[model samples]
Target: MKIATYNVNGVNGRLPVLLRWLEEEQPDIVCLQELKAAQDNFPEGAIRNLGYDVVWHGQKSWNGVALLSRVGKIHETRRGLPNDPDPSQSRYLEAAVNGVLIACLYLPNGNPRPGPKFDYKLVWFDTLIDHAATLAASGAPVVLAGDFNVMPAERDVYKPQRWVDDALFAPEVRAAFFRLLDQGWTDALRTIHPDETIYTFFDYFRNAFARNAGLRIDHFLLSPALKDRLVDAQVDRQVRGWEKTSDHAPVWIVLADR
Candidate 1:
């Protein structure tokens, strides 16, 4: 099965671009982040017309997440990340599709570091780490995919030194990501293309996309049970160049049938 993750930026504004990609790629499963629309604003009918079953958690003008399945029913499991007290953001959604547990997440973009936003980002990562450990121990075929908003290592970014003060590349943030991986989840893309400098997001400023200056922030983490099933992984970098497109592109993976 082909599974993909994309940060659409705003689902309503970029629905056309999303539709075009869906038609072209035809992935069996898709996880979308940054809908930036309210629940009522989600174009459910339009997506359903494409033969996909979707479950989404949406918020107004901010974070949101959704899971789409073409091969089977998407049995929603949860709408928000566990352990988040008074969680108001729609940043996480989980579902069971085709016997696999899929967690779609839009981690916080803690810009302008050394502040409350950055602190929140770290706290959120802690919650995710705690939850991921439990999921990994469950021994289920699980895929935790989405825009993590983190550059795992210096190699994952275009200029490591330049982003030293940036929250996305901060040592603490990177450490949190590693802590999650330590729970026995395999980074699918890095696993497949170990030495390659693959990237999924490019800044709109400074002609970053044109210059191939990007960061590999979107990811698919496969649990141990599904690690061997990972067949291929790639970033649809060209999609970033489309008109009125999102700053991020799609990152996808293929898994062999069990």
Candidate 2:
């Protein structure tokens, strides 16, 4: 099975680029973040025309998440965290597809440290940690994939020192991410390509893509029951260079059949 995650930034604005990539990759399942569209604004027809089934949770002009599965039916499991600090924000969507519990999330950017937004980020992280524990304990084949908005390790950032003060790299945030991993979820990409300097996002400014100044913020965390099936993981790195494309790239993982 092949599953992928991408932060499209805006669903309608990036429909062309999205459809193009979907055509090229044809992953069995896709978890999309940052739709930036209202519930009624999702480009369902465009995607359905491509022969995929989609379920989305949207909020106008802000965070949103969606799931696409071409392999089989998508049984929606949840739309947000058990105690999401900010339920008003459409940040999470979960479903059962092809026998795996898939979670699509878009963590807060939480810019400008030492402020409410930053505090909210931490609280939200704790909520996610709490919810993840239940999923981890369930021992189901679960895969949490999305733009987590944190660089968990120094190696995940292009220039670690420069971002130390940034919310995404704040020590507290990284620790929260590790706390979730401690529940037995494997970081698929890092586990497969550990010493490689791989990245999935680049700033649109300063020619970041051309210079390869990027960050690995998007991720796929596989539950203990699913980790052993991990066979391959990859980032569609060049997609970030495409015209009018999202700063983030698509990431995918291949798994052995159950």
Q: lDDT tens string, model 1, 238-257?
A: 89999999999999999999
CA displacement after TM-score superposition, residue 124 of candidate 2 (Å)? 0.9
lDDT of 1: 0.94
Write down the lDDT of every candidate, Cα atoms only.
0.94, 0.94
Q: After superposition, how far is residue 158 of candidate 2 from its true place, in Å?
A: 0.8
Any residue pairs clashing in model 2, and if so which? none
True lDDT of residue 18, candidate 2:
98
Model 2 C-alpha lDDT per residue in residues 97-170, reported as the tens digit of each score? 99999999999888889799999989988988898999999989999999999998988999898998899999
At residue 51, candidate 2 shows an lDDT of: 90
Model 1 alpha-carbon miss at residue 186, Å: 0.2
User: Which stretch of 10 consecutive residues in model 1 shows the poorest summed lDDT?
Assistant: 78-87
